[model samples]
Target chain A: MVRKRQILVIGNNTNGCTPKHEKIAYDIGSEIAKSDSVLISGGLGGVMEASSHGAHDANGFTVGIIPQDDASFANEFCDVVIPTGMGLTRDYLNALSADGVIIVGGGSGTLSEACASYMHKKPMVAIKNLGSSVDPYIDGYIDHRKNIKIIGVDTAQEAVKKILELITA
Target chain B: MVRKRQILVIGNNTNGCTPKHEKIAYDIGSEIAKSDSVLISGGLGGVMEASSHGAHDANGFTVGIIPQDDASFANEFCDVVIPTGMGLTRDYLNALSADGVIIVGGGSGTLSEACASYMHKKPMVAIKNLGSSVDPYIDGYIDHRKNIKIIGVDTAQEAVKKILELITA
Candidate 1:
């Protein structure tokens, strides 16, 4: 049996982001479902919840890798909740488990996850967000390694499209 | 019930470290076992193995948080092996699960664990070593946060003692 491809979406939590960001995340999740890939996320609020909600609504498989020990801590939409009990370090776990990654209107935690994914050689793409923590790496590489540039996208469709293509290639 | 205190030791795998470093790590694990604290590490070779070996010989509990998906990857001395399957990012899981952290001779992976632990506000200390990657933070905090000082100790005994005291107090 072929293991399902898991695409991770990392971003701001319930706070510090705009409604537009949530919509994009939701769309990304929908796109992931349509492509027949599994949706994976931090399994908290904000973008994580929004994406999972979108996927759930679309009958897509969704997995939430949460930092807390309690499985119930996962957002209601997560079909599979893996409570890491590792606090914020769970960020790396999500990045590690995914074939590719995406960022949407994130702060410090998002940047850390993005950076960790790059360090581990995971391909990534980001939705363009003004003043977002990930702005520096949008359409560019995180550092000198330049292993795989963090591609920037204008729409949720393109974000998933680019990541799938990048990882498959 | 008072939970067992889990003390983590992070450091180089099997390479780039001296035998003297391994001896110190082993002694530190022995001290942790003697104090009835559970020992934790990356669960691979070098310092991780030596420390687990010391703790196991002392009949102490040892938990190895390994990076691979397979539990068999852990060093034999580990009593409990948590196969994270998150690759190098599993470094953060070790730091997050520990009440305190001790750094033996290490490289970039160790530094990442140390930094993540500090970010999550875990007390930490290091065995003083000349020109180790952790030398810069030996007597200071990782960054300006100075949330809790990363104490430096001369011997394994001191390292364990200082970290225990810092975490409890």
Candidate 2:
């Protein structure tokens, strides 16, 4: 039997996120997990930790792909810890390994991963007003937005709705 | 005449070095600026802010490729702020545009950028004991290290020395 691929949450560690983003990510993550979608993240702090926590609380499997060798650094919520001795490339692998990518609040690092996702033709979802540098793809530019699927939602429920629709559809 | 390229420091958002990393990144940034190297960062707080402050104090150009559109989110030291509107992907460009990459105290985000530099085949320098990762690469996993050249040094002087040596040699 073929194992189902997981959903990669390409989150940002920028200034950390507000309570709103945390709530949104948590809600969406929980919903996604209830649907039996496996969650993966950078396994540190910020959205990765938040999403993992949400998934874990929902009794779903979570994977934290850490750049360091020590599993001690893995997110407290991760059930499976894959320690990559390769440093930051672990994030790249996280993006590449995902069947689809969802970007929560982010900074330059989030944008880089999005670019990689775009370059690799991966489906992407952006939580609106999350304050990402790539906000323009959804907000400002319409033509460029069509090149890649940029799904924007106001609520976490809607966010998960769109994500599930895109993935399962 | 070809314009000289700048040195971009891309690494973890967390100050893995704590109070010491702030001072170290500041010192190295100042030195690099004095030697006419422009400093670039992910444009968030912590090391990004510290190094930008150092370059600014030296009256050198400091560029912050921020993930957000608002220039106010950037540190006060930034002279050139590229509002990437791309989030973490902006950090990837910051690494791509650099002649070389310097890693200070970093976490997963920093590791991601370092890996990008490696994939892009850029020369890199790491502040010894500053990174939780890179130990394996420096020890003997030259094959795992790939096309990028990795050098480890204790002092800012040594980092500069090794970078110059790699460049000149």
Candidate 3:
């Protein structure tokens, strides 16, 4: 049996994200779902919510690595809520769990996730013009010596395509 | 009855930290223990290991928020190991569980913890010259308008003292 790909989506919680970011995240979610891949996120508001919403609309499975121990904090679109009382540190789990990561607009939290993804050596694709805190480091891998690279793309469709190619390659 | 103060120590895991960082972390741990406060860390290696060792020597309670689900991942100095199974996302719990935070030399993981502490409104103190990734944001709090501040000090003793004052105030 072929293993279903798990694509982790990292983004702003809500207050920091713009409507354009939300649309991109939603599209990314939909694309991942259409490809028969599972969508995973931090399971809160903003980008997480938007992406999960898109995936759910497409009848795709969505998992949320919630910081709280209870599933109550999970967004409405999350189908599988893994309540990890670990809090923001859960970004490591979010990154490690993914076959690939899709980054949207975010602040410090999103930046943390991006760093975690790089550290874990996961393939990452950042949607361009998100103005995320991870932007500063996106141009290069974690360091000159590391093989990990974060590909940049303009649209969600391109991000999905690139991520699929990366993971499959 | 007074609750025992919990001090969160943020630093790099073994692979990313230096001997100087380990020494400073050890001193901070010792100071925290002598002050009758519990030491908290991510519980992997490097600064976390050194600090936990110092706290153990001083007969202080040590808590490690382990990223893995198994307790075996926790360092020897950790008196209590909370197997978060949440990976790096556990940084949020490590920050929120503390009454205050002490930053030693750190990398991406430490940066995440510092950001989490700021977002949670926890008092923080960075040991100067530790070369932590949080240096960029240490001067100002997470928000310019917020009253929260991360005090910087030259010595471990001064850091402990300042943190106590901030928490007490």
Candidate 4:
């Protein structure tokens, strides 16, 4: 039996996220559900919550890697909760669990996830103008040789499409 | 038997680290060894390497929480290697294992560690002028109530002293 694709969605946990960022995250979650892909996130508020809500609304399986040992940190939409008790370090677990990573607006936490994804050699797609603080570091590719590239997209649909292609290819 | 204090040293893991950062990390490691405290780090290069070397030179017990599954990712000075295979996510393990955290110059990775330490409610002491990228976020205390504070010191000696006070208190 073929395994379902797991995509990790990374973003900020604060209320500072704009309406557009939340909408994009929600759309990405819906697309992932429609495609029968498993959605994974940090399981906190803001973008993570929005995406999980979308996935749950679409009847998609959602996993949240929570930093605390309690399930209370998880959003309302999470189907499965993995309490890591690793604090923000749980970001690594979220990235490593996914076949591909989709980043929305984020801060240092999201940037750490991006770095971890790059180090783990996971394909990543970043939605443009998402208020991601790691923009300077994500210079298309991670290295001078330009072998590893963080694919950029303009919209949620494009980001999901790119993630599908990367996962399949 | 009383448990030996565990001191986590966080810093830049790249060649871009300045000479002064290296010296402070080395000093912090030496102090940790002299105090019979176990030293821990990410077990990579730059400041991590320097601090590990200092601890090893002092014959201190040093542990490296490696992000990769391979033991080779650990620095030469690491006496004990915990290969987590979790990539940068292993930073949480490093922070959680320590009685206190001493931060040297760092970037996003170190900033993630700082955030984790705050969330875990661990006492942290940062060496001043360490080129820490999380300066803006480190508003002394992490929360609105200003209960948790990250003590800032101007020198390695001061950092060690502060760490000892925090851990023992």
Which candidate has the highest TM-score of all?
3
Query: Which ranges in model 2 have alpha carbons more than 4 Å from their true place?
Result: A1-169, B14-17, B139-145
Cα lDDT tens digits, model 3, B1-169, are: 7779999988878876788888888988999999999999888899999999989998898999988999999999999999988666677778889899998867777777776777678899898766666665675654333446777888878988888888888
Best by lDDT: 3
Per-model TM-score versus the true fold: 0.59, 0.53, 0.81, 0.71
- Clash list (residue pairs), candidate 4: B105-B130
Residue-level lDDT for B36 in candidate 1: 98
State the fnat of candidate 2 relative to the true structure. 0.02
Error of 2 at A67 (Å): 23
Candidate 3 Cα lDDT to native: 0.84
Candidate 4, A14-86: lDDT as tens digits = 6567788889999999999999999999998889999998899998999999989999878888999998886
> Over the full model, what C-alpha lDDT does candidate 1 score relative to the true structure?
0.83
Candidates sorted by DockQ, best first:
3, 4, 1, 2
List where candidate 1 sits over 4 angstroms from the true fold.
A1-5, A15-38, A52-97, A104-121, A126-161, B1-5, B15-38, B52-97, B104-121, B126-161
**Scored by Cα lDDT, where does model 4 land?**
0.82
Error of 4 at A126 (Å): 4.3
Please give, for residues B1-169, the per-residue lDDT of candidate 1 as tens digits. Answer: 9889999998777875578988998998899999999999999998999999999899899999998999999999999999988788777778779999999867556766776777778898888863354566677765433556778888999999898899889
Residues A27-57, model 1: lDDT tens digits: 9999999888999999999999999888888
Total residue pair clashes for candidate 1: 0
